[model samples]
Target: MEPPEIRFQILYYLYNKYYGGQTGKLHSAEKIIQETELKNIDRNLINGDIAYLYSSDLVTGKRSIGNGGYPPSIIITNKGIDLVENIINEIIVNILNQQDNRIVKNKIELIAKSDQRTRITKIWGYVKEKPELFVNIGEKALKLFLSGGY
Candidate 1:
């Protein structure tokens, strides 16, 4: 069976991108949802994810006055980063062991040919419009993945 998706992944990605190694940085839920490209993630799911993260001592949220009027901004802790790293490592190892190199290559090609390409293209447009926000997020994510023991 496929392992459940860890919400910490999205949290860590945000933390790493915006917090610059700090434990807590105020980020609105709407911003997080948009930045993470969490397609169709509802309010209930977001609330549940935040609750789980908070319970695990991975993230903390606070009320903030922003464009969204009362959005809670969340910050990630060191524990969250560690959790995300572990999950990513596990995924990389599993992928490396279970799939042949050719299969992996083909899958990447297929992804490039299919929906991911369009999605990435759209993200690129946003990035171009707001270069400062997405500056190193993609590069950092790629670097992290490549440095793993895949």
Candidate 2:
């Protein structure tokens, strides 16, 4: 079985894709798997992960009864959205503290103040336009933050 953290990542990814402007949206399991690039993972495993989130009140969805295609749709709860946003804020603050460059720090601060949706978009824009700005953050940390992990 995958670690619990991996399962939790599903919740985070859902928040990034569907929260904020798209709040309360219900998306197909197939669409979610494709977006997160978890297509190779078994449908049952995804169902188990969704079940875990559901049990935690972080999500609402139907899990396929067997190991076949994942049925129905999924929605992230407000609680789940808050959880992901809080983690992101913590990560941004940590990155800002570690950064000595004033310019980089300011940029990160701006991104942090924005809504979750805007933050992700801004971060990616920065990454693509000014890769050098995030050199001090370390690749692993940056990747984690970008991939919906703290």
Candidate 3:
């Protein structure tokens, strides 16, 4: 189950990254609010989310050494990479097994069943374009199927 607080935090983090995090810059709360469309910015909620991320070692914060301090800049850590990898792997596995085929398939039916069809199609298309990626995915799928854990 997804927690509302976590969901909000994830959205906020993505919003910040979309705006300027990619450039190694921090966005202000107002900017985050504007981008995320969350009404009545709740400091408590934001703080809670930050705390959770911090606890998970997914982000870190520091005070800026300037006249007017800016909001803490967040960076994804190795833990964050692991988290994203796990999520992506789970999503790929789920979409591939939609028909309970016990293996990954290149059928549109299974891809369409995914909530993010466009993303799934794009990812699978990319995988198809790259023989190495396809081989890796196929190996992983075969391992899972042979293990009888699907």
lDDT of 2 by residue, 1-150 (tens): 243444545766677667456666787767877876477888777776666567667777666667343336778888777765655565576667777888888888888888767886566456547656655443544355433343
Clashing pairs in 1: none
Model 3 stretches astray by more than 4 angstroms = 1-23, 37-43, 63-71, 99-150
Q: What would the TM-scores of all predictions be?
A: 0.54, 0.63, 0.45
Error of 3 at 75 (Å): 2.3
Please count the clashing residue pairs in each candidate, in the order shown. 0, 0, 0
Ranking by TM-score: 2, 1, 3
lDDT of 3 by residue, 31-137 (tens): 55455535455655555555555555555446456513323455555554444334445546655654344434565345545654244334445455654535555
Clashing pairs in 3: none
TM-score result, candidate 2: 0.63
For candidate 3, the per-residue lDDT at 57 reads 59
Highest lDDT, which number? 2
Model 3 scores a C-alpha lDDT of 0.46
Error of 2 at 92 (Å): 0.9
